[model samples]
Target: MKIEIWSDVMCPFCYIGKNNFEKALEKLPFKDEVEVEWKSFQLDPTLHPDETKTTFEYFKEKKGVPETQARQMIGQVSQMGKNSGIEFNFENAIITNTFSAHKLLHLAKKYNIADKMEEALFIAHFIDGKNVGNIDTLIALAESLGIDKNGAQQALTSEEFNDDVQKDFSEAKNHGISGVPFFILNGKYSVSGAQPVEFFTGALQQTYDETVSPLKSLSGNENSCDADGCSI
Candidate 1:
């Protein structure tokens, strides 16, 4: 069974969903058989490079929410992150264009280190508050995962992998995905949001059974909805 996740690195719920999915996999009976793919999805493609906006400031200015309310929301997200063994430091988080980071992820995927890179990028942005949008930081993180630093730097500097990243984003749009953390199981069943571990575990089991038995329909009689934020 293969699971493709379309998510953004800056998305807090996506990180939570990733952790939850991993936990579910740990307990899964066929954990080793399952293949996971991390696809790219940018929350804001038009984000500028020179923009030095803090997450708090960005939310406040873009959403017109007061600073206090934004801080409260960040606190809530931070606590939720703590529950998943993630230390979220909202104070140091700086919002930047993630297109380059997504490109690096594509390179990591080619090296079979996509999952590790995803986790590291999430930690860099949300926990350590490192500038994941920067090429230097991305290359350093990739090198830490045994990826060739020179290759990573060249890939980052060049336009290579840009088309792959864009293709994934375009495919997500074609699937009507308007949000991060979207999960597509075996290209049949789809789940959205940071659902509970039980949900993911059940999905994996169902996917596994369907893959093993071709006579079974994964969705059964359930109606599949478009990606307009509908419940599964």
Candidate 2:
């Protein structure tokens, strides 16, 4: 089975859902056969690096909410992250553009370390509060992940893999995917949001069954959630 996941590096649910999906795969009979491909998606394409404010401030400003409310929402998401063994320290997370971060993931794909790249970026942004949009920070991350830092810098500085990133966005639009953390199973079944582990397990079982049973498809498309405060 092939699983394609569309996610942004900064999306908390993307990280959580990925964890849940992996756990589900572990329970499946064909887990070893599963190929997961992480596709790039930017929640905030127009957002620039803002050093004066944290992500909490940016959240409050973007949604026109009180600072307290933003904290509460972050708290809820943090608690959810904890359920999946993620320690979310969003209190001081630096808000920055993630287009470069996504590009780095694309570059990591060549080195067969895209999954590690995703985890590293999420940990840096959510726990360490590192600025993923900074070219220097991204290069450092690439170096740590065993990818060529100089090559990563070249790609980030130029238009390398940019079209590949844009193509993912266009495909998401064409598929009516207005969300992050969206999972496509065998390029047919779609699961949205950070659903329960059983939901993913059931999806895996059902997809696997269809391949063995030779059944016809009847159900239509599924709905999903968009990124908070950003258009998908």
Candidate 3:
């Protein structure tokens, strides 16, 4: 089974959803049979590179909300993140373009380290107060994850995975995904938001039973009769 997740690195719910999905997978019967793919989705594409706007300020200015309300909203989200074991420091988080970061994730996928890279990028921005949009910081973080720094640097500087990232984004649009943390189970069922672990476990089990199981041939034949058994 393949599970594709479309999310943004800076999105709090994406981090939480990642943890929730992992937790659910831990108890899944076919956990080892599952392949997870991370897709790219930018919440704000037009953000300037040099912009130093905090998350609260960006939401306040873009949504026309008062600063106080924006802070409260951030606090609420931060508390929710704490419940999921993520330390979110929205006050120090800088809103910038994530196109490059998404491209890096594409490269990470090739090395089979996409999940770790995604988690590191999220922590760098939301918790560690690092600029994930910066090439230097990204290279350091990738190196820490055992990725070749030179290769990572070249990948970031060059347009290596630009087309691939855009393809993921286009696919998200085709799937009518308007938010981050969207999970597509077995490329058929779609679940949005940071759903609970039970939701993920149930979906995984249901998909496995309906599509991946060997007994699927017995699904729609209530009146059928076999050589050894007969039913009305």
Candidate 4:
């Protein structure tokens, strides 16, 4: 089974959802049989890379939300994140474009390190409050994950993976995905937001039940005898 997740590195819920989903995966019976693919989706694409504003600042200026309301909103998310074992430092979160980080994810996907890259990006932005939009920061983070920094840098500076990232965005829009951390399980079951662990566990069980098929003879019908009838 393939599980594709459309998310953004800067989205707080995406980080929380990652942890929650991983927790659920840990207990899933068919977890080893599942393949997870991380897709790109920018919550705020128009943001500039050199943005110096924090999350609260951006939300306040862009949405006209007051400072206290923004803090409350972030506090709620922070509490939710803590429940998932993620320590979110929203106070220091730098609001910037995630395009570079998303591109790096496409690059990492080539080396089968997409999940590692995604987690690194999330940690950089949410916990460490580093600017994921920065090329050097991205390279450093990738290096820490054992990913080739030179390769990552080349992919970052050039237009490489740009279209790949955009394609992910386009597909998300086509699917009417208006939010981050959207999960598509086996291309059949869709889960939105950072749902509870039990919810994901249930979805995993349901998908597994619906997909696992009993052995059948495809070439021809086998001779069988039952109380009701006998067939050849």
lDDT against the true structure, each candidate: 0.89, 0.86, 0.88, 0.88
Name the runs in model 1 displaced over 4 angstroms.
213-232
Distance (Å) between predicted and true CA of 200, model 4? 0.3
- Show the colliding residue pairs in model 1: none
Q: How far is candidate 2 from the true structure (C-alpha RMSD, Å)?
A: 12.2
Q: What digit string (tens of lDDT, one per residue) describes model 4 on residues 1-232?
A: 8899999988888888999898999997778898999999988877777766788789888889999998888889889998989999988888888899998899888888899889988888888989888999989987887778788789999998999999999999999999989999888889999998988899887887777645555665458777878787
Error of 1 at 166 (Å): 0.5
Best by lDDT: 1
Candidate 1, residues 1-232: lDDT per residue as tens digits? 7899999988999999999999999997789888999999999877786565788788987779888999998899888888877788889898988999999999999999899999999989988888888989999999899999899999999999989999999999999999989999989899999888899999888887877545745465445556575455
Local error of candidate 4 at 37, Å?
Answer: 0.3
Regions of model 2 farther than 4 Å from truth = 49-52, 212-232
Tens-digit per-residue lDDT, 112-228, candidate 3: 999999988998989888888898988998899898989999999998999999999999999999998999989778889987888889988998887787763636767889997
Q: Give the C-alpha miss distance for residue 84 in model 4, angstroms.
A: 1.0
Candidate 2 backbone clash number: 0
lDDT of 2 by residue, 1-232 (tens): 7889999988899999989988989988788888899998888787865443577678777768788888888889989999988888888688778888989999999998998999899988988988898889999999998878779899888999899899999989988888889998997799999987889999988987876446766763345345544333
User: What TM-scores do the predictions have?
Assistant: 0.89, 0.88, 0.91, 0.91
TM-score of 1: 0.89
Lowest-lDDT window of 10 residues in candidate 4? 213-222
**Which regions of candidate 3 fall more than 4 Å away from where they truly are?**
216-232
Quality of model 3 by C-alpha lDDT: 0.88
